[model samples]
Target chain A: MFLFFLSSGMFLGWSLGANDASNVFGTAVGSRMLRFRTAAILCCVFVILGSVISGAGATHTLGKLGAVNAVAGAFVVAFSAAMSVYLMTLARYPVSTSQAIVGAIIGWNLFSGSPTDSNALSKIIITWIVCPILSGIIAVISYKVVSVFILKRKIHMFRLDEMTRYGLVLMGAFGAFALGANNIANVVGVFLPVSPFGYIELFGDFCVSPAQQLFFLGSLAISVGVITYSKRVMDTVGSGIFKLSPVMALVAVWAHSVVLFLFASQRLEQLLLDLGLPTLPLVPVSSSQAIVGAVVGMGLLKGRHNIRWRTVGGIAGSWVTTPIFACLISFICLFILQNVFQQTVYLP
Target chain B: MAFISIFKNRTGIESEIDSFLNLASESGLIFMQGIDAYLLNNLDSFSEHLSHIVETEKEADTLRRSIEDLLYRKTLIPESRGDVLELIERMDALLGRFKGVMFRIEIERPNINSQFHTGLKSLSNCVIEAVESATLSLRSYFKDISQASDHIHKVAFWETEADKASTSLQKAIFNNNELGLDLKMQLRDLVRSIDKIADHAEDLADTLAIYVIKRSL
Candidate 1:
C-alpha cells in the first residue's frame, strides 16, 4: 500500500523526466554531438548528486505554495498533476510540470477550505513567463559574445567541433544537476507532510534526512523515465524548430542552467538579503520553457527564418491552459479519491 | 605534423577536407591521362579518358557541396571560410581547363606541325608541376603552415614557366605557314586554355599564403 501510494509521486517524477529532462541534453543528443548513452549517464549521475545535496532549498518554497496536509491527498494531487501533464503531452503541448504541480496544490487548498495564498500563486505564474524571457535574452547576449570572441578566431572547424561537443557534455551535466536541485520540489514536496522514511545513517557519520530519502526515491523515478522514455522528446527538441549551431546550442543550455540555479539557490537568496538587494523569488521554473525560449532567442538572432511560429504559439497556448486544466483535474480527482473510495484523503 | 582528432571520421570537417584534397589530386592525374589519350589519337581511349575526367569532376563538385553544407549548418570556421572555399574553387578549375583543351583537340583535330608537339608536352608538364606544387602547398598549409611558403614559391615558379611556354607555343603555331590562319588562332586559343590551368593554380597558392598567415597570427 505504501508502494502503491508512492507510485503517484513516481508517476509525476516520470512525467518530469519525460518532459523536463530533455531540456538538459536534447540539443547535444539531437545534433548528434554527444551520443545519447553518454548524455543519459551524465544526466543520471549529476541529477542524483543535485537531488541529494541541494534539493532541500526549493521544497520550502513549494510548501508555501500550499501543503497537501495528508498522504492520500498528496497522492491524489500528484496523480492529478501527472494526469494533466500526460494529457497535455499527448495533445502535443509543451506543458510545464512546475505549473501543473502548483495548480494541483492550489486545488488542494481550495477543496479543503484553506486560504489560498494569491501572492505565492501569482509569483509562480509570473516566473513561468519571466524565466523563459530572461533565458532568451541571456542567450542573445551569449551568442554575440561567443561569436565575437571564439568564432572570430582563426580556428580549425574540427577543433571547434571537438570543443563544442565537450562543452555540451559539461554543460549538460550542469543542467541536469540544476534541474534536479530546483525541480525535485515538484516531485516530493507534497509527500513532505506525510513522509514515511526515518533518517538513515550513511558512511557511519552522515545522517540522511527523511526529506532527502524521499527526494532520493523521487529522483530514482526520474532516472527511470530518462532511461526509458525521454529519447523521443530529446530527438524532437534537438531536431525541432530552431536549427542550432554548436555554439548556439551551448549558449542556450548554459543560460538555462544559470537561470534555474539563480532562482533555486537558497544561498544566493540569503546573499541577496545580506547585501540588502532584491532576492530573486525562489520558485520552480520550467526547464522546457527556459530551453525553448533560449532556442527561440537564437532563432531571432539568426533572423527569424528558423523559428516555427506554430510551435511557439502551441507552447504558449498550453502554458495558460495547463494550470487551469490541472486545477480542475486535481479538484475532481481528490474529491473522488476522498469520498467515492471512502479514503481519508484529508484531515477534515 | 597536423593536429588530428579521432571524431572527424564521423563528420569532422578536417576529414572531409582531406577527402576533397584527395579527389583534387585524382582529377589532376586523370587530366594527364586525357591529354595522353588525345595526343596518341586513340579515340576509344580518348572517350574513356574524357568520360573519366567528367565523372571525377562531378564527384569533386559533389564533395565540395557536401562540405559547404556542413560548414553553413554549423559554420565552425567562420573566419577562414571564404578563403577555404575560394581555394577549393580554384583547385577545381585545373580539371575544367584540362577538359576544355581535350575537347578542342578531339573535336577540331588541329593538324599541328610536329615541332609544336614538344612545346605542348613541355607546357603540359609545367601545368602538372604548377598543380602539384599548389596542392602540396595546400597540404602543408593545413599540416605545418610555416613550410607552406616553400611550396607556394614552387607553384609560382611553375606557373610562370607554364605561361612563358604556352605563349611561345602560340607564337610557333602562328609562325607556321602550312597551318590555316583559322587553325593558328584555334591552336593559340588551345595553348591559352591550357595556360589558364596554371593560372588557377597560381591563384590558389596566393590565396593559401594569405590564409595561412592569418591563421598563424
Candidate 2:
C-alpha cells in the first residue's frame, strides 16, 4: 500500500527529470558541442549521487512548509502538483514544479487544519523571486571574466573550441548534480513524513538511512525519465528557444548550477553560519528559472535591446498563475478523496 | 585518454593547416621566380619553377581537402567550421591562379624586348608581395585573430603597389613605337593577368576581415 501511494511521487520525479535535465545539458547538446548520449549518462549518474548524498537539505525546508503526515495525503499532494504542471504546460504557460509543489502542500495544510509555517512559506516565496535575479548576476560576471580571459590568452581557434567542449561537459555534470540535490524535494518531499522504508545496516559501521533509500528510489525514477524522455526537450531548449554560443552556454549553465547549489547546499549554509554570516534558505528553486535568468543576464550584458520584454512578461505571469492553479486543484482533489472515496487525507 | 586524443587531433590539424598555408606562400615565391627566369631568357629555369609551382598547388589542394574532411569527420570547431573551410578554398584558388599565370607565360612564349624586362620583374615582385601578405593574414587568423588585422591591412597596401607597377609597365609598352601593335597588346594582356592575382588577393582579404569580426568573442 505504501508503494502504491508512492507511485504518484515517482511520476512527479519522472516529470521533473524530463523537464529539468534539459536545463542542464540542452545547450551543450543543442550546439553540437557534446553528444546527447554522453550528456544523458553523466546527468543520470550525478543526479542519483546528488540525491543520495545531498538531497536532504531542501527536502527538510519543504517538509517544514507543510508536512502531510499521511501517505495518502502526500500522494494526493504530489498528484495535484503534477496535474497542475501538465495543465499549465498545455496552456502554453511556463510552469515550475517547485512553485506547484509548494502551493499543493499549502492546500494540504488548509485541508488538514494544520498550521502553515509562515516563516518557511515566506522563505520559499522570496527565493523564487531571488533565484532568477541571482543567477542572472552570476552569469553576467562569469561571462565577462571568461571572455576577457580568452582574449588575453589568445588561444588558437581549434584549441579554444576543444577547451569549450570540455568545459560544457564538466559544467553539465555539475549542473545535473545540483539539480538533483535541490529539486528532489519538489519530486518527493511530501512522502518524507510517511516514508515506509527502514534504515538498512550495510557493514558493522555503515548504514543507509530511510531518507537516503527514499531519495535513491525517487532519483531512479528521475534517471529513467532522463533516459526515455529528455532528448526532445533538450533539443528544443538547446536550439529552438534562442541560439547560444558554446561559451555563453557554458557560462549560463554554470551560473544556474551555482545558484541551485547555493540554495541546496547544507555545508555551504553551515560554513556561512560558522563565519557569522547570513545563510541563504535551503529551498528547492526552479532550474528553468535559473537558466532563463542566466540567458537574460547575457542579453542584458549584450544590450537592453537584445531582451524580449513580451516573453519575459509571459513567463512572469505564469509563475503566479501556476501556484494558484495547483492550490485549487489540490483543495478540490483532497475534498473528493475525503468525502466521496471516504479516504483519510488529513490527520485531524 | 580522451584528453590525450583531443590534443593529438588538434595538434595534427593545426600542423596540417600551417603546412597548407606554407604551400600557398611558397607558390607565390615560385611564381615570382618563374617570371624572373622568363625575363632573363632562361627557358630551362622558367620550366623548372613552373613545375615546382604546379606541384605546390596540387599539394595545397590535397591538404585543404584533408583538413576539410577531418573538420567534418571529427565535428571539430562547429561554430567556425564553415568560415574556415571557405577561407581555405579561397586561398587554394589563389594558389591555382599563380599556377595559371605560369602556364600562360609558358604557353604564349611572348617575345619580350630588353626594355620591358625590368618593368615586368617589378610587377611580378609587387604581385608576389600582395599574395604573401594575404597568406600571412590567413595564418594569423588561425593562430591569433588579433594579429590577423596586422597582416590583413598589408594585403591592400601591396595590392595598391602592384596596381601602380602594372599601370606604369603597361604605359611603357604602349609608348614604345619600336614594337608592333599586336606585341604591345600581348604584353598589356600579360601585365593585366599578373595584376589580377593581386586584385583577387585583396578581395580575399576583405572576406577575411568579415570572418574575423564574426569570430570575435
Candidate 3:
C-alpha cells in the first residue's frame, strides 16, 4: 500500500516534469538566451532545492483539500491529474498542472461528500483570476518605470543594455527558485498524511511526519520534470508572446515572482487585506497566466498597438477553459475507470 | 634544457598563430567594410578592392580550417574542443559569404544600377556591424560574460534595423521606373543574399552568447 502511493507520486512527478518544468526556463530557451541543456540543468537543481525548502505550503494545501488520507485516494488524485496534464501536452495546448490538480482534487472530493472548504476553494479560484491580472498590471507599471528611467537618465545605451541582460539572468534565476519551492507541493503534498512515521518528536510530542519526506519526493519529481520535459515549454514561453528585450524579460520575470511570492506567503496575505484591499489568498496559481500577464503588461507600457492581442487572448482563453475542461474529462474518466473495471477500487 | 626547448617551441607556434589570426581579422574587417563601400560608391577602386578582399577571404578560410583541426587535436576537454571548432567554422562562414557577395558584385558590376547599389549598401552595412560586433566579443572572452552584452544588443538591434532598412530599399527598387526588368530581377536576388549575411551574423552572435554564458566566460 505504501509502495502504491509512493510509485503513484513518482508517476505524477514525471508527468509534472513533462508539463510544468517548462514554465521555469521556457522563455529563456524560447528567446534564444539559453540552450536546452543549460536550462535543463538549472531547472533540475533549483526546482529540487525549491521543493525541499519551500514546497511545504502547497503540499499541505493539496493533502487536506481533497481528503487524500488513504494511499488509494492519493493514487486516484495523482492518476487523474497526470492523465489530464498528459492529454493537454499531447494536444500542444499549454495547460496548468495546478489547475488540473485542483480539478482532480475536486473530482475525488465529490465522492467523499465534498468536504472541501469553500474558503480554500474560493481562495484558489480567486488566485486563478487575480494572479494574471495583478501580474499584468505590475508588469506594465514596472516596465513603465524602467523605461522612464532609461529615457530620463539618458543612460549610455551600452551600459543600459549590459545592466538589462545581467538583470534578466538574475530575475530568471529568482523566478526558477520560486517555482521549485512553490509548485513541488502540487506533486507530493497528497502523500503526507499516509507517511508511515508521523512528525518527528523534536522536544516533546512535537514530531515531523512523512509529509516532509513526501514533499522531498515530489521535489525530486519536479527536478525530473525540469531535466526531461521542460525544454519544449521553455521554448514556447520564451518566444511565444513577444520578442523580449532583456529589460522587458527581467520585468516580466520579476512581476511573476512577486505574484508567486504573494500566493506562497501567509503573512503578506493578511497585511494586504488589512489595508482595505480585496485580497486573494495564496493558492497555487498558474505560472503560465502570471508570465503572460507580465508580458502583456510590458507590451501595454509600449502602448495598445505594441500588445499582441491575439497571443494574449489565446493564453487567456486557455487559462479560463483548461480547468473546466480538465474537470469534465477527469470526472468522466473516473466514471469510466470505475464502471469499466468494477473490481478495481477506482475511487476511495 | 628540455623545458626551455618546449617553451621556445610553444611560444613560436603561439606567436605564429596570433599573427595569422590578426591578419585574418584585419583582412576580414577590411573585406566587410569594402563590401559596404562598394554598395555606397559603386566605384571602380572599391570593386577592385572587393576582388582582392575575396582572395584574402579564401586565405582566412584556409587558416581557420587549420586552426580548427589543431584545436580539435590539442584540447583535452571534448566539449570545449567541439565548441571552439564550431565557433571557428561559423565565423569563417561569415567571411565566406562576404566573399560570395564580392564575387557577385564582380560579375554584376557592368550592369549594376543605382537601385541595386542602394539596397545592397544597407544590407552590407548590417553585415559589417554584425561581424564587427562578433569580433569585438571574441576579443573579450576572458572577461565577464556580461561584458559581451553590448555586442549581443548591437546584433539584435541592427538585425531589426536592417530588416526595416531592407524593406524600404526593396520598395525603392520596385517603385523605381529607371531600371531595366532584367537588372531589377537580378538586384532583387542580390538584396536577399546580402540580407542573409546579417541573419547569419545574428545566428552566430546568439550561439556565441550561449557559449559564453554556459562556460561563464
Q: Of the candidates shown, which would achieve the greatest DockQ relative to the real structure? A: 2
- Model 3 scores a TM of 0.58
Per-model TM-score versus the true fold:
0.71, 0.90, 0.58
What clash count goes with each model? 0, 0, 10
List interface RMSDs for the candidates, in order.
7.7, 1.3, 14.9
Candidate 1 lDDT for residue A27: 79
User: Lowest summed lDDT over 10 consecutive residues: which window, candidate 3 chain B?
Assistant: B71-80
Per-residue accuracy of model 3 over A256-307 as CA lDDT, tens digit each: 8788777777777788878977665656778777887777776666657866
Better of 1 and 2 by DockQ: 2
| Candidate rank order under DockQ | 2, 1, 3
True contacts kept of 2: 0.61
Q: Would candidate 3 be rated incorrect, acceptable, medium or high by CAPRI criteria? A: incorrect
True-vs-predicted CA distance for residue A29, candidate 1, Å: 2.3
Write the residue-wise lDDT of candidate 1 on B1-217 in tens digits: 1113335432566777788778777766777777676677667887888788778778878878877776666544544566778787777777677777777777888766678878988898899889889888887765556678999999999999998999889888877888888888888888888888898899889888888776542
Q: Candidate 2: which stretches are off by over 4 Å?
A: A53-61, A86-95, A189-213, A235-237, A264-282, A307-311
Taking the candidates in order, what DockQ does each have?
Answer: 0.15, 0.68, 0.04
Determine the C-alpha RMSD for candidate 2 after optimal superposition of all C-alphas. 3.0
**Deviation of model 3 at A8, angstroms:** 2.9
lDDT of 1 by residue, A1-348 (tens): 777888898998887777777799987876667667878888888888888789987654445777667888888888888888877666545568878877887888888887778898888878988998998998899878876665356445456666777788888988888778877877886677577789899899999999899889888888887887777777656767576766777887887877787777889999999999998888777888888888888889877977888877877888887788878988898889888988877776
